[model samples]
Target: MRLRRHSLPEPRIQSKHTGMLQRFYNDVVLALGHGCGSSHLAGWRRCPPALTIICALTLGLSCKVHAQAAGNDADNANNTPAAPTCLPDGSGSLKARLSGAVQAELVWGNEGTECTGAVRPDGGIRVRFSHKDGVDGGRLVLLFGIAALREGQSAKALPVNVTVIREGLGEFYSTQGDNKCTLDEVRQEPLVGIPHRSRSYRIIARGFCTHPARAVRGNGVILLPRFDYVGRIDFDAEDKDETLEGGAMTAQGRMKQQ
Candidate 1:
């Protein structure tokens, strides 16, 4: 028998869905800039951009559905207002099953026992992690202190290190070991960078602790890693140098720990 010939499928045409996605980001940036709080995120689900992306991904696989899923990306770009660089303070976002919201407030680390009443670094940065809950759900707080930070440390600045020293692994899951976890494989990017007019630094840190339990999906155990928090973080080190609570400071970063 002779083999049949097949032609490749054409690309999908454009649609309004593309603009919907842009609007989503616009709203998100706007919400973050205004300090909308975690409550504003609930609207993301009802946001049309999600459905537009889903349609583009799953249904668009087939050439027949491609055109239907196509969206006009330019439509929204032309209509939306100019979005300024959003530098959040004490509030951020989390990427989870539902894209949870996080509130990472930056405070003096002197209160925690782990610090041992040791003085914060002069021109150095140190932070500690604690589980936090928002109106919608849970997030993390970065109790931190920065001292003697020179203006030049902005670029090539040292990694602002923080360790999760909590022993409450059992609180979220059945097993333990996630306690005393450190941020590993962290990726950082400066948004409103320091050493500049902007006050915050955009950074991403990964390697959140794995859940203490596993799931059995079939004959083999299904690997279910828990508490892997990742998102953006905005850190500001202008004040509170060499002293805890001596001056005011704030933190809101989105990090990814994979």
Candidate 2:
């Protein structure tokens, strides 16, 4: 298959510099013409002054051309985008690989609970996940918030579907709608049996008032977050809204199971 080539945008010229050069060129030409006219009335047999003016005019035109060329070069330099940098191995820049399961917890923006329909006094939290190796596929175990409040009882894990959009920056996943499950709660949970791949991965979670099954539709990535790595996750529903609308994004990290 043939790859298509796209045209780049034209470089912008600096208005101030362009105007200055234009004015300089006009002044030089006018000076040359004025001097030539004055020299013609000097009573000289030959118009020696006019000839000298001609030479000066020619030099000025050359200088203007040179200046334009230099300006174009500068414009082109400024317009070029910087190339992407390659990450080094074992750089300690990212600690994605963990020995076991990563915990997911709620951090902010909790209005209510989906299961019990109880009003949440405190808001929910957003969860974020970062890992070495790209997060390919994973299972999520969702539990109700009030259930965890009971003595000697843990929140039950509900089945969930996962999809990752951006590699390292984050993945999108769906969970059952509950006010207690804040973005931070989702980020602090563990993602079990995820296949390992090479790349840094970032996972962020947000809970909406919608059902988890409804959120998994279309193209989205999912993974549970643990308490340790969940602190880095940020909760902003506006971002989730964009993803829901199929917005474009660029990733600064990658994730996979170790």
Candidate 3:
């Protein structure tokens, strides 16, 4: 704003030091032009000498401040080191096997839940399961928020957002690995919960690792209806008029009988 109103300041170019400083400023401005909207450095480098001096002076102060800020960050990190966590053996794969009666259920964004909401995936807690190998396995995850199951609608078609995930089992599943993965079958099926009898679905899908690592991968189908539906969803809905319309999503799953 100030620059727009007043004439640019003249650089009192005197000594070789001043010339060197001006060149340095020009280089810095050219390099940083992209951040301010210029796609190429040539345009910014062609700026007037006065503008270059002004930007150079401003950049000089900024560099000093940035260096100080970085130093402070390093000091803070050194002073407040992270708490040591338990290191597991081998790799960070989920150790627990899912099957039969031994089950796991999560209902976040509910009345009593703290995290797993419509917008953000904050407030996640560690959920542990007894591994078949006797190792207590766990994953830190914030499940996507759940909405009321529309009758005759598959859960796959529901709109939900996930925010954050901790570095652990959940991260492994969510983050893509270097090796490609393929699904054998993916469709929505019955999501029958023994206690919570509502519209639910189990994703009937089989995953295959294109390049097997350590001669291992997920076994059987996604167990325990953790998927709760087997279907495909393509969302084209856009938000307009304070609502989402014109977007379409298709789901295929059985709604639990009322």
**Clashes per model (N, Cα, C within 3 A):** 23, 57, 14
For model 1, the superposed segments whose C-alpha errors exceed 4 Å read 1-91, 95-180, 193-199, 209-258
The TM-score, computed over Cα atoms with residue i paired to residue i, of candidate 3 is 0.20
Clashes of 3: 14
TM-score of each: 0.24, 0.30, 0.20
What tens-digit string does per-residue lDDT give for candidate 1 at 131-239? Answer: 3333434433333222323322332222222222112221111111223233443433444644356633433333332332211111111112222222233234323
Give the lowest summed-lDDT range of ten residues in model 2: 110-119
What is the TM-score (0 to 1) of candidate 1? Answer: 0.24
How much is the lDDT of residue 136 in candidate 1? Answer: 32
Candidate 1 yields a Cα-based lDDT of 0.31
What are the Cα lDDT values of the candidates?
0.31, 0.31, 0.30
Write the residue-wise lDDT of candidate 2 on 110-224 in tens digits: 1111111111223322222222232444322222222122111123332222222333434334333343133232222112222132112223223222222222323332333
The TM-score ranking, best first, is 2, 1, 3
> Where does model 2 exceed 4 Å of error?
1-122, 128-164, 167-172, 175-258
